[model samples]
Target: MDRIRKIFLVSINNIRKWATNPRIYVLFILITMFLWSSIRPILSFSKEMGIRVTPWVFPHLASSFVGQLILMLGVVLLFCDAPFIDEGQPYFLIRSGRYTWGMGQVFYIMMGMTIYLLIVNFISILILMPNIFLSTGWGKILGTLAENHGESVNEIEYISKKILLSYTPLKAFVLSFILEWCAGTALALLMFVINICLNRAAGATIASLIILLDYAIYSNFPSVKFFYFSPVSLSKLILIDSKGISNYPSNEYAYIFFIITIIVLSIISVLSVRRKDIQVQPAV
Candidate 1:
């Protein structure tokens, strides 16, 4: 109990220290405000042009930007100055139970993302709320519903009933938040692992080269079937609709594969930390 409390406090303090830093806060606020501002013009343009863009798309874009920001932060705070721990010296996490510290870090990141997503979601909803309300007239609503229906039963009416029954925008936002966060965190952890494995400059260059090579291969190769599992590829789903992808996995399969990949990578990370020696540096 005492150990858990200590780990939690340490994690909280670490996050707070990062948050309170003037440069970090400035960067975060600027990026967030920029993204918030973008939603209005996008929504207005979509409305004027009669584009069928989802209200969720703005938040999804904001989430991806946030993911990139978090990745930068992780690189700065966790790996920038890490040094090899000598056998004679006791590493902080090794002494404090590495697993607890690692899990605490993941929780801290998730919390940060949750707060960011909430802010972005709020801004997006503010932009779309007026449209949703004013467009509630029978004709407008019917038109919207008509656009949604296929050759089968009406999608708009069915969705309207669900909405009337209290499936509010807040609920939808929260559901999207969970899915986006899962996808983001999993990709971030995997990136961290790769970064650790490739600590040198040459290795970083090779990683970049490999990324370009893979892009070419995936586009040109006839047999590269599992590109969807790649972080760069899968992350696109958050912004673009599933239908927009050239090779998107089926809805059910994507979720299953994503969850499994995340779980497996998370497990591998934990095992590496437990058994492998990491020359992790301190956040400057």
Candidate 2:
């Protein structure tokens, strides 16, 4: 129990130090650019039509393939400095024991990813503050855009019709958030494991290569077999057909794939931290 508390303390301290982290600002800047492009179109459509929207705009903003791609890349930048270690970390690790320290690093990944995703969602809502409202439905313009968005609608504005037909606004938003969190956490873990087992440069590089590879393979291949191994695809609900007859993997399969991958990577992370000589260099 005391060890658990110590681990939590380490994780919390890491979170607190995020104020000193430059990457956090860079992440927000990236997110704002991506989100502004996404939300601006919706806001424009709403103003032209004079119709208020539901609070579920975030899902649509993140629904497109391009949005997801940028998001994956941004998350890579967000946690690029995985294991979040500095010169001060070595002394702390000595006091906390590598086992507790390793677990704390894992906790940091979980917390950090959660914060990243929540910021995305919050900014989406914030952008649409006056124009959007709390509602169970996808609202006027979103509903139309989802099903039969005419030529008048900008190409930048998008929400999958399959999403509207298959799930409610709340469900779509909830699922998108959950899936992104899972995939982002998985990527962070991959970086963490590699950073501990190998070197920092290799860790970030390999994780990025995997992401680019995943996007290329899935984008080009588009096969059910491929989805079984792809991390980013699991975040895409549009790929999953409601009838279960499409080529995409089912929801159940995506969850299992993510859970298994995260668990295995997390186990490796703990083991690596405990057994490996994880050297920390001074922050420059």
- For this target, which candidate reaches the highest TM-score against the unseen true structure? 2
**Window of ten residues with lowest summed lDDT in model 1:** 150-159
Give the Å shift of residue 105 in candidate 1: 2.5
lDDT of 1: 0.46
C-alpha TM-scores of all predictions:
0.56, 0.94
Clashes of 2: 0
Question: Across residues 9-32, which tens digit of lDDT does each residue of candidate 2 receive?
Answer: 888888887788787787798889
- lDDT of each model, Cα atoms only? 0.46, 0.79
Candidate 1 local lDDT, 143-176, one digit each (tens): 3433453112221122232222222334434544
| CA lDDT, candidate 2, residue 67 | 84
For residue 190, model 2's alpha carbon misses the true position, in angstroms, by: 0.5
Candidate RMSDs in order? 8.6, 1.7
C-alpha lDDT of residue 61 in model 2 = 55
